[model samples]
Target: MTGTAGSSRSILEGRGERSGRRSGGTRTLLIGLVADPGFATEIAHRLAEELPGALAERSGYRLHCRVTVVSETLSRGEGERIIDLAAQRRAREGWDFVVCLTDLPLSANQGYLVGDLSRRANAAVVSVPALDMLRPAEQARDIVVRLILEWAGELPADSGDQEIEGGGVGVRSGVQPVAPTDEDIDVEYAAPAGRLRLLVGMVRVNRPWRLVWGLRNAVAAGLASAAFGLVSSVVWQLSGAMSALRLGIATVASLAMIVLWLILNHNLWQHADRRDRVEYRQVRLYNAATMLTLVIGCGVAYVVLLAGSLATGWFVVVPQVLSAVIGHPAHVSDYLRLAWLVSSIGTIGGALGSGLESEDSVRTATYGSRERHRPPREPQHT
Candidate 1:
């Protein structure tokens, strides 16, 4: 009877310990999603919906996602150090881990960084430009999840650390794993960032389509140029005489001219820190993004002009008049040729019209939020 009573007391003690654990609940890991304004913000907002659930499923931990959906440009003397910016926020917020999403190009020493991970601080920076533009949010989710899992010791020890020629086994190819270069960083993915991919991403982040409205003056001037060409017999003859190849070249040249005019007129290029390789690459990246934004803006202008010219030509220009100039009956091809030629001519007017736009207008249209926050690039006084 004494033995039976002792066993009953032990069961009560076991029940009490289990109840105590139930009251405590599972430990919650805090994950911060800090993004630069624009696409990065969009990605963060998107991930916030699924990240907690996804991380919990993948890492077997309860997760609380904290999203900062604006520009977190940490000011430093050398300007924004992406890694430091992320690490500081992680420490300040007391988050178990942080993942910074940014469209700004991240340079690592001499090479470009695809991912910058500081295991010690439990923070990482994912350069959105380095990921494939198609479905970047999904790619970012995968990367962020893996990094968190690796840091939490949930992933296998050998799974994510080995460096391969193009990439680590599970990570994206052409983005090789990196050993820590910075004192604060523990793991990194530094590769020759695909220049075209980076440029495209930068253009996407700049949201050049916004320029369509921003350059109202440019559009107005282009429409005026197209209107004049439609009424002119000389323009009709010239457009008809031009071959398809010539029309394509003219389109490219005119677009280039407008892009150049905007860059030179507004002083949009980043001029500082060209002597150091890292600074040179960064400046080059920003300049390239600037050029691309203008090119895309011009490209949109050209399309608008082309469409307007075609519509105007159809309604205003008599078919018989165009046939008389080219010494052949006007066909659909003739109309296209005329529209193409007129659009090229119109884009030049856009170049001139762009001059009327304020520097702030051009600057805002051409740069991402990070660059927008920066003072305009100035000339070296030396």
Candidate 2:
């Protein structure tokens, strides 16, 4: 109970330091993680971060475990290939367990698979994309733990220690442990979803940054910037017309439009159940996050526009051009007006950027949705 799961912070650094001191005497387990680059790296880091804490609780020998990514992704039907490669490399570069993670959706027998392990090969592959949960990293961690346990024969094959909702199947082995009472069985098998929720709760205990960058928020922001640029000119003119109040109005107007666009099209609250629709409080939270993201994106766009305008103004503001355009040397007010004008337009472009991005991209970029509640699957042969 003392080593119970709670925090998901990166224990690698601290644990590595401690483990290094004991390496001379302690046995070491090297885990190879092959993952697709982008989001898979996040999962790998999360796994590394949580592994020490999660494993500390399990009864085991005092061994040092080091997790390394294979620097490549494996596609469907590539698990065995990776395993073979790992085996080949094992002679020179040894690994105790090799787990491959891919962002690609994977299925077996037309059923989804979050991950699968083969004890004979001491290798495993996890489909990060197929994992549906608010905190997928923790689920991935749990699967890895079970796989390790099963491989070590720490738990019986029929222990039913691991479970996933939707269509994922758990690894099984021939080893058997003592039978549990009917009540214990019920408690074990009946708690799949509950355990998953608890794991997520544990993973997210103090992590708030996940919400900001969970989905490809960076890509969304880029798309927003692009979209804002498209209609930026028109918005700039309208703002210019309000010359006296242009600066204040332009900033507010642009930020508002970008936030509105995200809320409407980002599917931030598209719950599967009508009753599960976000409440007013949740709505406020989502809006606040959206506002923050949009403001940052829009601000970047504004700065770029301002810089470009300043460069253009500097390069083209000869005496003749100034005489023709303003009948005076371009002043600070002129530059300020130009900056305000372009920022207003960029705001609209940011909205356009959101629309330009595919729905899937947007979905991949946001983390406020609860789609991870999708039914889990029973595991099948890959």
Candidate 3:
């Protein structure tokens, strides 16, 4: 009985220790992330998940983050106003910090800004599109975490401290160098022209997936081309007659037709002004990504056409039929030739299909979001 009692006492002691550890006080931080509509929302959500874990690990604080995606486009001109408005919202919503994420390319003194922070308001603005990698969520989260860490004075001294208008040291919040003034409505940050282009170069190196757009168009074009080629093959009676060079030429021709159609029909080649070197580079990168995706899409269409032709020949084109039609016995090679011929014709069909796609649809398919929705420029008065 004494042994059992001692064992029970030991179990209770262990339970008490566990309870004490579990009840340890942990600081709770509430963060609000505001994102522009569309793909930015997804990135915001991912940041919400990733930021809290990273912050908790780094600062030993229990962090809670929420994302609010807004439909109104964020403009550089309206940045301060937005930050102030976010501050107001924070007061009502009980958010300790708020950051607005946008896709619009922002510039100030011709340099790009990754984000801006207001120590007084405990708020910030982050340009999601300006970030150079495909994983915007991770990068945005890191930027926000760095801002929070700076605010908390938890970073190392060598980490480039920032001095803001409010006489507070800021970390690498990615804000412009322009100091804030008394006017709350003034735009405090500016990204230079070439910064965005530089980001594109980084994206090309680190994350090329960000540049991929218009998958639906590519798929539609490929399918249409394959179908067209299949029908043409049936009509022309060209089964089992194509050589390797002929097949290769057919594939190349089909891809070329689709690419040419897209270039002629869409604004894929539009660029920023000539004087703005950075914007030009951005436009060039965009065009390069579009063309690369287009080529890949055309290639998919060719493969589909070939597969369909082979399947059709195997199931429908009998040996007897081949002997009668082409004066030769049907074989696997005959089916392959049929498929190759059909894919070539399908490429032309893809061109026709390209015309049917709307400009808006193509843009949506190619780019997750429109460049910017700035107000129309007023007519210049001489």
**TM-score of each model, paired residue for residue:** 0.79, 0.43, 0.62
lDDT of 1 by residue, 1-382 (tens): 2443354233323434331233223334567888876677888888888777777676555333444444554444344466666777777875557788877777665356667766656678888777656666776776677676555545544555553222322345555566666786656765565678778877887788878877889889998998898888899989988888999999999898888887787777667665787667767778878877887877887888899999889888888988888899999888888888989988888889988987666766665334656644343377
Global lDDT of each candidate:
0.71, 0.48, 0.56
Better of 1 and 2 by lDDT: 1
Between candidates 2 and 3, the TM-score winner: 3
Q: How high is the lDDT of residue 223 in model 1?
A: 89
TM-score of 1: 0.79
Tens digit per residue, CA lDDT, model 3, 1-382 = 2443344233323434322233344444567777765566667778776777777665555333344444444443433456665676667766666777765444444366566766566677776655534445665676667666544444445544443322222333243445444343222443344544534533332222321233355546655655554544354366456568877887788778877787677755565787989677667655665565456555655566567667865676566766566666666776677767766766677677777666665553233224433443343479
Highest TM-score: which candidate? Answer: 1
Q: State which candidate, 1 or 3, has the greater lDDT.
A: 1
Model 2 ranges off by over 4 Å = 1-25, 32-62, 70-245, 269-291, 317-320, 323-327, 369-382
Q: Which residue runs does candidate 3 get wrong by more than 4 Å?
A: 1-29, 36-39, 62-95, 103-137, 156-239, 297-310, 323-329, 367-369, 372-382
Could you give the C-alpha RMSD of every candidate to the true structure, in order shown? 9.2, 13.3, 12.8
Q: Global lDDT for candidate 2?
A: 0.48
lDDT of 1 at 267: 73
